[model samples]
Target: MKIQVSTELLDGCVLALLAEKDYYGYAITQRIQQTIPISESTLYPVLRRLHKESWLETYDESFKGRNRRYYRLTKAGTKQLGVIRNDWESYKHNIDWLLKGDNHG
Candidate 1:
């Protein structure tokens, strides 16, 4: 069964992607889909929220006569990504321990 992803996790994922390089909204969605099952529709709001929160900055570039908005991580976003990654590691460790019924993760 596929488990539903949380908003925080989604935000982290987006931040991680942008940490590598800037991406347009559609490209971000496609890159994320390679590892997680997420829809384009679902990602826009995350981008909007990040942009609104000042965690992300955007610039529009022309591509094939159309302008595509590209997202890049800000200093705040980098800091947030570090926090999320730490939380994820802790959460994953605990969950793995519970699932395996062992002390090791």
Candidate 2:
């Protein structure tokens, strides 16, 4: 079954990927696609938004004589990732509780 991913989650995923290391746009989309169903188009705007928000910084490197823009997480992005992770854990726990009808004490 297909599930919709929230924009906040998408941002988190991107930040988490960048947290590991810097990556170009295509590489970021490919890595995210391995776990989530998303198109390259869906990601570009996210990258742009993150860049505008100052959460991500980009640098261009020549790859095969072509400039590839790579994204690196900024301090703000790392802080945002932490917030997303905490929120996800809470959301997941609530969903699991509702689905399983089990107390997670």
**Which has the greatest lDDT?**
2
lDDT per residue for candidate 1 within 38-75, as digits (tens), equals 99999999999999999999999999999999999999
Q: In candidate 1, what residue range of length 10 has the lowest lDDT sum? A: 96-105
| Pairs that clash in candidate 2 | none
* TM-scores for all predictions: 0.95, 0.95
Local distance difference test scores for all models: 0.96, 0.97
Each prediction's Cα RMSD? 2.0, 1.9
Local error of candidate 2 at 17, Å?
A: 0.5
| lDDT string, candidate 2, 61-93, tens digits | 999999999999999999999999999999999
**Residue pairs with clashing backbones, model 1:** none
Which residue ranges in model 1 land beyond 4 Å of their true spot?
A: 103-105
